[model samples]
Target: MCGFIGFLSNTNINSENKNNLTNMSSIINHRGPDECGEYIDDNIILCFRRLSIIALDSGKQPFSYDNNNYKLIFNGEIYNYIELREQIIKDKNITFSTDAEGEVILAYYKHYGKSFVSKLRGMFSFVIWDKINNKIIGARDPFGIKPFYYSESSRGLYFGSELKSFTKNKEIYKKEINSKSLHDYLTFQFVPEHNTMFENIKLLKPGHILEKKINQKTKFEAYWTCKFDPILKPQAEKIKDIKKALEESVKLHMRSDVPVGCFLSGGIDSTIITALSAKINPNIKTFTIGFKDEGYSEIELAKKTAENLGVENINITISPEEYMEAVPKVIWHLDGPVADPSVIPIYYICKEARKHVTVMLSGEGSDELFGGYNIYREPNSLKLFKHLPTPLCKILKYISTIFPEGMKGKSFLERGTTPIEKRYLGNAKIFKDHEKKPYLKSYNKNYTYDLVTKPLYDKCKNYNDVTKMQYIDINTWLKGDILVKSDRMSMANSLELRVPFLDKEVFKVASTLTLDEKINEKTTKYLLRESFKDILPEDTVSRKKLGYPVPIRKWLKKEMYDWALNIIKNSKADEYINKEKVIELLNKHKNGKIDYSRKLWVLITFIIWYEKFIEEV
Candidate 1:
């Protein structure tokens, strides 16, 4: 609902530097366009852009608490602020103030110190200047629904809701690209958490707090995580629990000062959200996007569902030129590369939805919570493969690798025989371990995606195979691509996007579902579908989750091939990429020898991103 930028430094606050803090606010104006506020003092300066969702007159930031001893600048909603404020007033004798949500953060932190973050129930990223302690403390939400970026330099520590804010600092802007992240990007399709494209900048991990004392090293510590300890219950009982949880979550998420809409994709996740939301508020507006490619479009399905629910549906068709032009603009808002092609459609959908509503409810995190991805079913078939002797399986893996590329059953043999940690990275596997070698100027096997996923796996070691894969995705893919894209794209249009499925209450129920409840031998999210089978359209409850599909594969082979070739032809990424080898991959796809659409999409996105940030800047 807002964006904030803050600077902590021993450097004197000069007039020019103060002007730059205002400039930083201008750069992220799209995130919050209603009002602007700035706070400056001896050793620190803070800036804020407000969207004015709640307490329009009283909710302005950089607010000082305890009579100027502590100042706060926060970006997000604290849904339980009323409850927190009442508790603080009753138990701690803290009294009377504006009804702003972020005030609870200051009140709680005053009494509980770092542990105060554990008591929050909303999406947030906040910075508080503890002037008395001569340090700063910041925290992100439990599931990373909000974003926080920070960098340390000789000037000071610069932190903001976006990475583009760092561009205001000369030193932070001059750092070299993080090649390790580039290689990992090609593999996982997004820069993983903790690291960004710039070597010096990093994301504040979800459910963690960062503490910076005057001249001491900064430290980060986690406060929450997803756990999969199934409470083996009857299928009927689990289904009822999921229904009650989702209903409660959807009701809580509907708390908004402005009119809220839903992005209906015709998939179970969005369909479920739309159905539940319509039941509460019948006049809710719904939006959907479709491509020219009929195979990839779901406008008809979404419209049909909208008709059944008797809610007004607004649908738009994305033209090729509009999609092409929005690519660079979308990358600009993303702050870093997210190679997921679906970001394109999300950008358009949010842009259109912003025209009619200020807030929208979306469907994300349901897949990771309850088994939703089709790939999670792989472990079911691989169970027998895991029963084979290790020596024979290793021999079979070697033999399978020798078969020609695209051979049937080759990928199955390789994945089934190998361990989950080695085989499953996330929902996507763009450039294989071998495929990445010839394409990058620098490659390190140590820079593998496992560096990002393995720790998550270790945390969920007690989980079943399907749950382990879900954990990896909830940590990596969901945070990096799904949530990031959803947040950035929606904020780019100055519209707040809320996820009913990602609520902590919903996750609590989902975490307790057994694998059999999450998935069966044939379908994913079986329990979730059956829980609302009667309410959802008969077609939607049984439909596959294709997401908001973008036909980049077909476009690259047809209409956009020349456009993509030209980008690779006159390239500036030679220092980071092997030009000839990338061209070979592009040529093979053009000649129909291989389906290199995803591989080329990864390259094209990164190249455009590199040009916009590295070259154009």
Candidate 2:
């Protein structure tokens, strides 16, 4: 809902420096174009840009508590702030002023200290400046709904809601790419937590807080963790509990002063959200994006769902050309390369929805929590790997290497033969290890596919195969890729997106369901569909899942090939990547020799990001 930038120094600051902080906040002015404010003390300077979501008239940023001893700047929504405030006042016997969520946050922090995060039940990333303790306390939300990046420079420690804010300081070094993060981006499409694509800058892990003491060391620790406790409860009992919990979460998430809307896709997740929302408010408006391509068009399904729910629906259809043109603007707004092609249309959708409402509800966390992805079906299909003779699997892998290029089923043979650790990097594995090695000028082993997957594999030692993949996704894929796109793209339009599926109460029930229930009968999200069977249309509850399907693959083969080639050929990305190799890959794809849609898109996005942010020109 807002953008904040602050710096904590070990020495006294002057007016000139204060002006610099003001300018830094201005760079991210788009995030909070409604209002702006700044607060500075001897060793800390806090600045805020307000978007005016809940308390438009009186809710300003840099809110202070305890006679200005506790000052803070925030970027996100606190849906349960009212509930939290009532509990704090009653439990701690605290007096408060202003109905602003910002004030409630300060009071809660004062009463609970670091433990305050446990009581919070919303998306947020904020920094609290403790004038008395001469320290700064910061925390990101539990599911990483909002982003927070910080860097230590000669000026001191600088923190901001977006990366561009920290880069606003001219003296601070910029354009120093973090190779590890870049490699991760190339592999996973988004940089995971604790690693940004820039050295000396890091994303605050979700559910974690940092405390930096003046003239001393800074400490970061997690305040919460999402632990899976799969239950073997009956299907009927699970469905009953799930529906009850999800409905309550949706009800709680609807608590806002402004009108709320829902993002409706043809899929079950969005359909269920829309169906539930319509039950509470029949006039609820739903937004959907339609593409010209038949396979990718979900607007018709969304329209059907809306008609069934009897809610007003808005469908925005865009041509491939329009989506391509919107890419650069979206990348600039995102502030980093989140190479999800779906981000483009999602950004446009939010931009369109913002015209009607300030706050919109979405179905984001359902996939991660309820085993929604078709890839979750992979462990079931690939369970044979666990029973395969190790030597035979290795021999099959060796045989796959001898298979000629362009041969059908070769990649399948390779993927089946190789260990899951090496083959299934994440949900979307664009480039094979062999293919990527030829592209990187200097392959950094430290950031290879194993770097991201090994830690996950180790953590899932005792978990079932399905649970292992789910746990790995929660740690890597969900926060690193999906949520990043959702949060950044939606916020870039200054629209507050609330995810009921991500609500802690909903997660509590979903996380407790057994893998068999989640992946029952070889189908993904079976439990979820069963829970909402009565509310959703019978056809919708059983429809094949088509996830945010972009026509990028088909476009790259035909219409967009020329544009993609031009970008990759002329991009300044040559400094880091092998230009000839990139062109070779594109040429092969264009000539119909290979399917390089995923890799070409990744290369094109990286080039676009470099041209916009890294290259000075």
- RMSD of each candidate? 1.7, 1.8
Off by over 4 Å in 2: none
Candidate lDDT values, in order: 0.86, 0.82
Q: How does candidate 1 fare on TM-score?
A: 0.97
Clashes of each: 0, 0
> Native-vs-model 2 lDDT?
0.82
**Candidate 1, residue 443: how far the Cα is off, in Å:** 2.9
Give per-residue CA lDDT, model 1, range 1-617, as digits (tens). Answer: 89998878767678877877777778999988998888887778889988878777788888778888888888888776777889999998877678877677887888899898888877889999898998899999988999999888777788899988777766568647887889889989999888999889989999999998776678899898778778878888888889998897888778877889999988999999999999999999999999988798999999999998889999999977788889889998898888888898999999999999998999999999989999998888889886788899989899888979888888888888898888889998898766888888888777777777777888888877899899989888988889899999999999999998887778889988888888888789989999999999898888988898888877877778788888887889888877788778788887875688899888888888888787777
Residue 612 lDDT in candidate 1: 78
Pick the lDDT winner: 1
After superposing candidate 1 on the true structure, give the runs of residues whose Cα lies further than 4 Å from its correct spot: none
> In model 1, where is the ten-residue run with the lowest total lDDT?
166-175
